[model samples]
Target chain A: MTKKNSEAWKKKYEESGLRDADFSSISGRLLEPLYTWEDLAGSDPETRLGWPGDYPYTRGVHPSMYRGKLWTMRQFAGMGTPDQTNERYRFLLDKGQTGLSVAFDNPTLYGLDSDHPLAAGEVGKTGVAVDTLADMERLFAGIPLDRVSTSMTINAPAAWIFAMFLANAENHGIPFARLQGTLQNDILKEYIAQKEWIFPPEPHLRLITDLMVFCRDHVPQWNTISISGYHIREAGSTAAQELAFTLADGFCYVEHALKAGMDIDEFAPRLSFFFNSHLDFFEEIAKLRAARRIWARHMKKRYKAKSPRSWLCRFHVQTAGCSLTAQQPEINVVRTALEALAGVLGGCQSLHTNSMDEALALPSEKAVEIALRTQQINAFESGVATVIDPLGGSYYVERLTRDLEEEAERYFKRIDALGGVVRAIEQGFFQREITRAAYEYQMGLSRRKKILVGVNEFVNTGRRLEIPVLEIDESIERDQIRRLAEIKERRDNQAVRGRLEALRKAAAGSENLIPPLLEAARVHAALGEISEALVKVFGEYREQPFY
Target chain B: MAEQRIKVIIAKPGLDGHDRGAKVVARALVEAGMEVVYLGLQQTPESIVRAAVEEDADVVGISILSGAHMTHFRRIKELMDGQGLGDRLLTGGGIIPTKDQAKLKEIGVEKVFGPGDDLQEIIDYIRHWRAAQAR
Candidate 1:
């Protein structure tokens, strides 16, 4: 566009009486109201975007994309007893859901058992309670282990839970090579955002590397670490911060494995990602596209990864829970649908659309069904999946994608200068950035600078929330405790003690910890017991006040 | 003579990992000229009360987003009363329903804030509660 035309456009916008706003992306980056080819001026599309399934996979990781296979509709569901969550899993799968994402309860996430004092009233409240191999078996009861892919959103005790899963699979006669799933084993994000960490960073990395090596040899189809930005975003980080911090964490893992004398190609292909699909339509899409480009480029160039599979940044997208509001909860459906669509358009391999009522409580069955149906409609009816990188080469998308890439590159340099992610996390850099961003966003809402439907605007104070909010019966904790007590009574006490002692010894020295952890799980060692054994050696991590 | 600042112990008293609300509230309290001691995640009620007693806090704010508010708050209230600290204000804010919040208030919780409750209003409530306690 000519300078005169641009000036005329600006004058027209000004004279139209539209209020001057921040015009920024949710990350506080100023967004141009319009974009032209001049924005992407000298960039060559062939070299930058290229075709799908190629190096620097900006467009997509798959050549055929969704035309070959629709993105997996994995709804993250769990609550109440193991039987209840098992029923929900079968229900979701019966409704044509392709995969299962397990959301463990708070106790499980913190490596505590349902019978622990701190677990009072919390057992099976947030998600399924799996304290031992028996609970894990019941959690997936009747679900064919080999036929389905399961993603466990457990971090701190991921290895323990993973061992329990493997034990459960072995009981079902499924080979380790046949097991396919992702572990939210990204403990760095725990330190930075989720705060579910047990041991300090160094030992946590040790546990993660053990899982990585074990999975690389045994569970070849498994994604050992889904380096996640989902919690980072839920902790109120901006899109750029989420992208940069997540990739930086991924780089740290790769560097760790390399230092341990592992080939990049052997494990890089199994390293997956989980990202948040937020409400900003263009920005979220751009973030995903930029994420793929950043991962592929860095893997091929920086890490010198040799294989094409190693360069893929395969990810699962969950529609942002932080964007869902407690007020006028139903409209969250629209928000989720749009975000899921962005995920599909941005070429996500799988997606989990959150329930509308999640901001209030654990999702009711009806709410979860609606969430699953949101993805169903997007994939089958929206006609969006038939095309690969449908938004490729669009002026705004390309410009924003490139801009986000550049911003993330800048963050990478800063993080490297801060001595990488672990040091940055210990120094509370990530926490500080996210806290400031969250505060600024809250301030924007209060100042009327941001318009959230049914919140601070549209004025829905009178409307009652009509949807059912699932309430966990307190009996769930009682039942879980009783079951745990039974397991403790019935299990071979000598064997359990022996295995736990072995695990503690393994933790004390430099050993691959998963084998001992698996042995403990095989002997009916509780999750909390395994975590405590390690805690005895590594101690617990307590964060200093950052705000 | 030195003026005393209101000491508020902000804590997460459950296995819940969400601390965005707690941190934001702590920062607001600090900016409002209160001495805020933030006890980070996975804190049990015993530990929280211990911190409250050790810190000599005028108020204890427990932030729970894990839907365990009823059990946690009741246990904490009982523990605080058992420890002869019933005069202190015990309050919190998160995903608690209005009806449950009212029940908690009836059960000895001083105030239970929910979503979109004004930050200034929280500041004012804490200050007013401390002033009333001073009397």
Candidate 2:
């Protein structure tokens, strides 16, 4: 864009009534009504974007991209017992799901057995409950672990759950090398946003590093840690915060691995990211582009990673669950489609379109099918995926991408000044920032500055939602506890005791915890038992006072 | 006689980590001059009821978005009764269906606020309830 052309465009924009209207992105970033060559006056294509598959991959990490193969349509579906979720998984796969994303129930996520008092009423409520290798076997019943890529949204006890998964695969005679999946072993994000941390940050990071090293050696195809901004965004972070904080956490993990004497190139390639695709269309696309570019540059320049594969920032995206409104719930389908489109446009390797009933309850099978079909339509009918980086060079998009990058860099500096992400987390820096953003956003809605269609405006009353809300029977808790009790009765208690003893010793020392975890899982030690063993050594984390 | 400031305990009594609604409602209560004791994420019903009794709360609002509202609310109700804090108003809001909300109210929940309900309504309800208690 030339100076003269930019000046002419600005003059035209000023003259136009449309340009005079108030404008801002969803994150409150100012948006120009008209963008021109002047917006990119400083942007050099090669330096800024490079090519789709090249260094500093602003466009995408893959050259052919979606043209060669469509993004993996992974619908995150899990609720009730393992048998029920197993059925849901098969249904989704039968309905053209390219991959599986498991949503563990609160009990499983908290590393508690279904029989625990704290786990009462929560077993398999939010997601599938897996208390032991037996539940894992049932959860993946008849589904081949080697054939499909699975992403489990679990933290805190991710190593223990993953141990169960490996044991399940071995029982099924599937080689560990053949297993392909991602573990949401992102404890940093747990402390920062989700509030699901078990141990303090240091020990949690040790567990993560252990998983990374173990996966690097055995399950080479597995993504050991999915550095997640999805939960951060869901926790009310702005787009820039999500980008900056998630990348910072990724860098923290990289630094941890390096400190543990692991070669960056050996493990970095397996590092994956999960981001939220919110309502902001262009901003999300720009955020994804900026994310890839920042990651590639940092890996090459800052970390000095030797492998070109290490420079690729492969990511999965799920449509924002927070955006699904309870009022006029059917319209959430449209919102999800748009968000999914943005994710696809932004070059996600895998995507999950949130179901319409998400705001009300767990997605019904019909809702899940629609969510899956939304991705299929985008891939087959929309023709948007026919080319790589389809919206790469647009003046508006490029300007937005550059702006997002700059904002994220500013945040990176802020995080660094606060003494890196971990210290920032300890100081409640991330929580405060996210809380303020959430409060402001809520205030915006109340003040009518932001119209949420059916929520703030276009008001509908006396409307009954006829859509089926999936009811999780309370009997699930009883069933789960009974099963857990049976497992405890049947498993070799002596072997379990020995493994837990060894686990306690390892936890006391600085040992890679995966081997002990695997041994315990093999002995059919319950998730809570193994987690309790570690908690004995590494005391549990209680959040520093943050309102 | 000087009026006591209304004490409230905002509780998350389930596994669901979605606390946006709870935090928003807590902010409203705080703005309304109520002292709030926030029981953070993944709290059990017994813990919530214990907090309510310990905080000497006028209201015990248990926010649960997960579908286990029936179990949690019922459990909390039982604990509240056992703890002899039945006078403390039990109220909450989430993705709960109107039918379930009715059932919950029938089972002794004071009021059930659904999604997008006016925060002022919550404040007004709590204040009104507190006044009735005093009377």
Candidate 3:
């Protein structure tokens, strides 16, 4: 009957000239018209979905998912210098933000300093720039280190950045045991999608494992990693691919730690996930629901994680930036609002809405606030958060969630066939899948099958109203470079070199690189210097371009 | 002798690692029957200019997402001028706002392909510009 309904819908679509119309995106995942128990044949809904916070917990993670506590209203924001980022931090905190998430500038992401030769023209151009302990100190200026959970979005030099963060907090009267926040120390996503990497994979994995072990020992409040699918979706992956590949990356990280002799309960409790809520409304929600079920089942059955906290697959969701259009920029606000609503309905732990103006540039302060308010309205006004997984029992939603789960499971089998994430990454499996998805999405858009409101349909002509944009001063780069040089002149060169050499020794040996890194950051050895030592020891990573 | 196809070097010239645009543009050029050499991220203007010369590319295309287009394009232009390769075709593609696009043209960037600009249009522009120069 559902098949017949889908066929009828397809027929109606065809009769309405959707065949000639651009039905590529809207029609890609052909849905069956009316789903019944037959659509969920051979499946026990109760056992599969279970009760809230139960095993194979497809219904919802928490017994009181949002009724107990509303999701974290954390929007990813940071730009210009660390000082500039601090001002934004205080602004967000004052405006009811509950978390502190830092976005490192491009040079910082690549383990380069503001003064490095390659960093010359790019310091503080993309995100916030942090070079040394002082820069990290200034970034947190007046904010209390122990009070807020700070998440730093840095890879490659995640160890160095986390080290500086630890040093800064220690100086600010916070103990290691009190550290709370997440570091996006997921290197798989870097190699797979974001491409901000320094050392080769093996050594990089070692550093990541070190962070996991050290944090497990010291910072119990800290989430040591957020295996990110946000970038995978940003790189244009299908929902199934994003779900499968991200969890696969998580599984690989677990296996790495497990092999390093860490207990499943010790580290798994702090593991967190990050996802992208794309413009496809029901599909994005279904992806999140399916992800929770998949992660929960995998942990229980495969790893035998003893703790319920380990079973709880908490994730932060960001509305898709790739979905925003440059042609009709304002409509992106509506698109982001819908996507944010899906995140809420999908039971995301935290949400970040993309500003409408993001396709053209970094959002203006007003645009970012509006994006935040979009989430706020959904929370306080829309009243969607009052219910946990409100759409869970809907036959349509439940089936879609199952369909996404099965499809993602198929992808998992294929990755397993390819011998897991590392082999697949080396073989460029993730890269190939995402590139194909990106191509297909663009093809849909170009064929005029996907109606991007401001771009293709319901056009707004004669609107020359200029929105205020974030104008970056070119002098920021020069200023940053000069500051880096001054820091270079003051720091003891021999001490810095000594710490870096010790870092390299640790890297080349069996020792975890974090302690040496913290020591290096304490002495003001720049992030770039620490990375350069590892690069010398491990060599620079060069990825082969995909054909 | 067979006519040598137009060669284009598409480079991602800055710190932004979002290469979907760069990769898509590279594929478009390949589909257009051009020999395209894609120099991936963290490329200095020196590296780009050198690659253009080494590949003997007829056109050099720079894709920026780090929003440092003004400084990056200026550096490329300066390097091109100093190396006496100013006559070589230069173009850029990315999220160039209208105001910045205008300023970029003023700074001697041959053409600017902002978001949603057609790949076919770019190929046509490069062809027509080269033809006009020949005339």
Candidate 4:
């Protein structure tokens, strides 16, 4: 009877003649006019999607999900000097932000001090600059490290920054066991998508494995690596590419750590993922769902992770920065709200909503507040957090979830065929794929296949909307350099020199570099100095520039 | 005689790794039948100007989203002037604000494109500049 009704509806639908439009997801997946039980085929929900908090956690990671506790509202914040960013963090915390996510400036991200020549105009510009433990101290002055969980978006120099963070926490008399935070130390994605790196892949993976082992032994509560697809999507990869590449990187890390002799259950629990919640609502949700299921299956069967914690794939989501338009900037608030909702519906552990004016500048205080409030409204008023996997049983969502998993699986096989993630990265496979996708996306916008509202369609040609852009004071650079100079004058230079020498020795040998790094941070060694020591040993990485 | 295609060099200055805009614009310029050289990422103002002089490019375009555009543009424009490449157009795009765009113009940047701008608009701008220069 259902088949007969579906046939009749299809006949009627053809006769009715739908409007001419690109009826496809933003990722270019064609949409069906209607979905039915037949789309699910012989897949049993009992195995494919068990109960929430159970095996193959497709429904949700936790049984209670957001009912017991809501997702952490962690907004990625930083600008200007450490003191200024501290004020912003204080403001955010006071405004009911649950977690702190640090955004370091490009110089700091590249392991350079604020006073470095390449760091001239970039000092305290895009994000906060921390050159030493003193700067890290000022960055978290009022905020107690023990109380709130922090997430630092530092890769390449993640070890240095994280060591500085630990040194700061130790000065605050906070025990490492009590501290909770995350390091965005996923280096593989940096080479493939973000294009930020210091050392080559082999040495970089070694640093990551060392950190994983260190975190397992010491900072047990801290998430060591946020295997990120956020930048992959931001770099203009399709949703499936993001899913596939991110998981592939995650599995590679697991393989590396396993080879390094760390037990799967020991560090895998703290292995977190970060995804970009793009404009496509259902697609984003399905991607997140499929991510949890795939990770869980691989951890249990393939890797043989004994602990259930190892199988759980916890992730943080940020609203797609690429989706925000410069024209009609106010509409970005609407875009961010919808994207944030997708993150919630898709089961993100933490969320960072991009400010409306981010497409213009970093984001003024006013703009950031509104972005934070958007999450508050969703959590409290929208009633979305009241249920776990609300769209789980829906045929359309399930079909998409299954389809995304299959697509990601196909990519995994391809990546495996190309040796592995690092090898593929060396071969420029990921870069070529992403550049192709990014080019195609632009072509779509130009050809009118994709509509970006104010950009391609809604025509806002009268005058540009003058939203308040957060301007970093020019003097911050001079002030930051002076502060660094002062620290250099005050610090025990002999101790710093000794510590850096030890770090270089450790980097040269197969010894874990974190203990020596932490020792260097304790002596108030400059980030650039320590990085120079390591750079002498590991050497630098220069990309082939595929695009 | 074969008409000369407008020569354009698109480079990303500073440490900002966001290259979606740079790559897209480069591809668009190539698609528009322009002679294009893409200096991928982490380029300094000196390197950009040096490349522009060596290539004898008609236009030197930079894509900067690191909020260091003010310093980069000023330095690149200065270097271009010093290197005797002052006649060439210095144009680029990224997440640049209106006021900064105005400031950049006063400092001799031809034009700064932002989000939602038509690819053809940029293509036309380059073509028109080349045509006017020939006149």
Candidate 5:
């Protein structure tokens, strides 16, 4: 045998008495004693890890990130009727929440009002129901339009929901450019995990692009879309799968925008991301850093985005809802804190921490406050923000970051081979991956390979533990229906019909639907009208039923 | 007969998109060796009942976290009574308190399961109830 081959084999044998080929999770991953020049041999770590507020911002997007402005602590809060939900909104703001993330009721989500036949018994249950401008006004009663940035978590009828917010803000006399925040306007991930989509992909992508163009030209400060990975993770995926699939989805959207005769720089800068803070500590942190670096390189080299903002990957994070356990519910607070820290260390611009009582129901006021406070404690007490990418130079972290990026890039090739993400989704690639990952997680727990503190391992008291679960006021249904009845009675039915007619015409044309929906919203046209108008142009998307 | 398998249609009858619990219960029911059909998120009472009638399922199980469980369950029960399904066992599970559980039963729901409920126990209850219906 050659002398060089003999020496390599001898070294590996001495280390573990086995070949170095028998590792899975962290192998092609470089583990270092300390990340030095030797660790970054083939890669220019500095050019890749550029300064905050510079081109290819792998460090962060802003120069004085938290030192200038602490990350926006936007808690995901909603439930019941608009009035009740509005009260919660005011409460959250009073407690120092900088932004608003509204969760819509099931009826509102499905484009039905409280009194709709299909909406029976379901209104104001999952989230606040807003049938018309009246409920939207009640939802933002005391809150000023020009001040707090609002993020609406709607997908199927996102354009309508966004139009409602815009109409409300305009009525409040706030101009368009003054608005800030995001709409989960991401319809692609709907096909992946959430399953709340209204129209099919072609029309849905058109709707998403419509918002992007409208927001780019009009609502400059507003984020048009937040390409989401949080739902993908919550639906059951490993940290790596979540990272890969989410970035893949983002890439697909970028490509779609480019194909639509739109410049990448025009829409790409305003595009943001949403990720989940799962329980895996360092792994989650590495995933975020890798996301930024990979996105930066891809945007600059592939898409030719000249602006640094276009390259910088900024995201909002919510703690993993699936991580919370129904058993020993109080432990969720500790879990949320750890995941929030992961988000911060990973450099999220805005974050929503899940409540301890979330496994039970929509968070009660106190439960939500605890959730917001988890972020507060992490920001103030933890001192994690004192240093930029505090875990950036760590040997294990860098190694894992490279390893995950490589794993994700492999998925990117498979996606490209399948034509693109939309085709891949149609072929059930993502669905299958998430299904397999979910099974693996459950199997791990079943075999005790993974540990859920209070669930599989810890012996808990069989007795019931009491905590306050939020109850939607029973009057909400009657109240919402009454409001809708009042709207139906009060509003100009003919004008609403004409505006909706305009919307239908616009939907058929290659025109943006937001402006027309906003016009419809001005006349207090119900969400149903706006959604059905779009539905007229774009038929509903049906999934291959899993169950 | 080994056992006349109790077939149940488990559904989330509102916009509550959270389905982890519903899915786990569906899996558990299948493991407990019963015929179960799960209608995913955003199902309405009318839609669920239609599915129940179409499937000819004996029991209807609902999982709601959207806090509209009280009103939602009431509508389901009312629909069933209207359709002559008053004999079919209707059950629920979610973040319901004890007070609401009593209220739910008053509205004619057979049982309410909250977090930490034993899937095996629910499976046995279904079997026992179905056998009693036969007798």
Candidate 6:
């Protein structure tokens, strides 16, 4: 009966005269014209999907999902000097943003002070520059450290930046136990995709393990690492690759932490994930579902974690920045809404919607407000969050979820054969895969196989959309450098030297680097100085150009 | 005599790690049968200029997405002129704004590409510039 019904539908589909276009998912997965029970053949829903908040959580991580608590609307915002970024943070908080996700400047991300030579043109270009704990203090001035949750997007210098945050909170009289936030301390993805690393993989992993251990004991509420696939997807990976590579990186961290003699349940609960909500709606949804299932199963069966909290795979999602167009940029609002919706339906714990003007420049206040309002409308107006796992039982989504799980398992086996994530990275495996995928996507665009509205298709060659882009003044760099120099002159140079020497000594020994880092932060030691001391012990990493 | 193939040096200046565009454009240049040299990430202006002079390349294309195009382009152009490679074309692409692109042109940057630009258009621009220089 099922076969006969499928045959009849296929006959009608053939005669329907649909447009001759690619009907595949963005990840190039071919989809049938219709899906039915036969698509989910031999797969028991109880074992494959299970209940929400149960073992192998594919429906959703929580029993209540968003019905209990809505996802945090955290817009990643930072620019110019610390004072300026502080004002922006205040503005976001005043405008009802639930959380603060800091976007550090490139120099800061590279562990460079504003006065460094390589930091000449990049002082405050991409995000805010925090040269020292003084800068961090000013960045969070007037903000309640005990109340609001902050997420810092720094990797290589994560320990240093995070130490500064802890020191600043201490100065504000907030204990480490009361602090709540997350740090993007995922260095594996940095090596694989983001290309922002200061040390080799071994030393980098050591820093991460130290941070994880420190946060687990000192700051129990803090999320030590947000294992990210956002950069992997932004670097031009398919949905399945992003899913597989990200989960593989997460598993590598778990394995490393377990090897460090730490209990699995102790650190696993603090491990969160960040993923890119790209243009593929159902594909992204399926990938997120598969991620939760894979992570839960691994934690329970593979790693032998006893706690249910350790089995939960909570994640944050950001709409794809690569999907925004430079041409009629306002149309990006529509694109972001759909992607953000997919993230919501995929059961993200937090969401960040990309601004329309991001393709041209940093988003202006108006543009950012519109982007945040998109989320507000989705939460308040749209009925998606009212129900848990709205698309859980759909045959198409279920089939896609299983397919993505198998795809990720295959990648896991391949990575294991290559001796794991770091070895695969050194062998240029991930780089080659991403390059091939990026090139293919670009080729598809050039060949007119893919249609990007207002870019490749629906060309607006006759006119241009005039949108306001937030401009960072040239004086921002000068002012930031001046501030750093002033702090250096006023601070006790003797104490700075002593702290940095202690840090260097600790780096050479088997000690947690966070204590020394926090000491240096307390002395107002510059980020560059601390980083240099560590880089002396842990050499630098250089990548071979793969194109 | 066989025509000289256009040689281009594609470099990423500054500390931004968004190299997907740079690598894609570099691969496209190679497929277009041009002699291309790709200088990977964390490149300084001096290093980029030195490579350009050493490669004796006719075109230097940079990709900057960290909003540092103004400082980078100005400094690189200045170094290129000071090093006596002023006649070579300097072009690039990124998330650069229209006004910044105009200012870049005033500093002798040939063109600045943005998202959604066709690869064929960039290839044609380089070939046409080389043809003009030859004339």
lDDT of each: 0.90, 0.89, 0.84, 0.92, 0.80, 0.93
lDDT of 2 by residue, A335-408 (tens): 99999999999999999999998888888999988888999999999999998898989999999888888888
Indicate whether candidate 2 or candidate 4 has the larger DockQ: 4
lDDT of 3 by residue, A1-547 (tens): 5678777776886676434443223326876545665666777878878887786667677789888888888878878877788898898898888888888888899998887777766788778888899899999999987888888788889989999999998888899998788999999998899999997787888888999999987888999899999999888788888898899999999999999999999999889999999888888888899999999989978999988778878899999988887776887899999999999888888888999888788888889889888988999999898877888777778888998899988988999999888889899999988887777776666556676666556666767446777877778878777777889899998999899999889888898888999999998888888888888889988888653
TM-score of 6: 0.99
Please give the range of 10 consecutive residues that has the lowest summed lDDT in model 4 chain B.
B109-118
- Candidate 1 achieves a global lDDT of 0.90
TM-score of 4: 0.99
Better of 5 and 6 by lDDT: 6
Task: Summarize candidate 6's per-residue lDDT along A299-414 as a digit string, tens digits.
Answer: 99999999999999999999999999999999999999999999999999999999999999999999999999999999999999999899988999999999999999999999
Estimate, for each residue in B1-135, the C-alpha lDDT of model 6 and write its tens digit.
877999999989889899999999999998998989999998989999999999999999999999989989999999999999999999999999998988987889958999989888899999999889999
Evaluated against the true structure, the overall lDDT of model 4 is: 0.92
Q: Candidate 5: which stretches are off by over 4 Å?
A: A1-44, A54-56, B1-8, B24-33, B53-59, B75-99, B102-135
Q: Provide candidate 4's TM-score on chain A.
A: 0.99
- Report how far residue B99 has shifted in candidate 3, in Å: 2.7
Candidate 3 error regions (>4 Å): A1-27, A457-464, B1-4
> DockQ of all candidates, in order?
0.62, 0.54, 0.57, 0.75, 0.36, 0.84
Task: Compute the DockQ of candidate 1.
Answer: 0.62
Write model 4 residue lDDT over B1-135, tens digit each, in one string.
Answer: 876988888998888888888888999999999989998888999888888989999999899889899999999999999999889999999989888988988999869998778898899999899889889
Query: Model 5, A1-547: lDDT tens per residue?
Result: 4557656765776786644231323111223323443445576777767787676666677887778788999987777777788888889889988999998887787777688876766677778888888888888998876878888888878888888888888888899999988888888888887777778788888888888888888999988888899998886777777788888888878887887778998999888899998887778888888888888889989888897778888999888887887778889999999999999988899999999987777788888888898899988988988877787667667767777788888988988999888898898788777765665555455545555787767748676566888776677778888878888888999999999999999999987778898899999999887888878878877767553
Model 6 stretches with alpha carbons more than 4 Å out: none
Better TM-score candidate (1, 5): 1
Candidate 1 local Cα displacement, residue A22, angstroms? 3.6
**For residues B3-31, could you state the per-residue lDDT of candidate 3 as single tens digits?**
46888888887677888877877787787
RMSD for each of the candidates: 2.0, 2.1, 2.5, 0.9, 4.4, 1.0
Q: Per-residue lDDT of A1-547 in model 1, one digit per residue for the tens?
A: 5878978988997788856566887778888878987788899999899899887889899888999989999999898888999999999999999999999999999999898888888889889999899988898999988989999999999999999999989888999999888998999999989989898899999888888999988999999999999999988899999999999999999999999889999999999999999988999999999999999999999999999999999999999998888888899999999999999998999999998988778889899999999999999898998889999999999999999899899999999999999999988999999999888887777677877888778866666666777878888889989999999999999999999999899888888988998899998999999888889999988888656
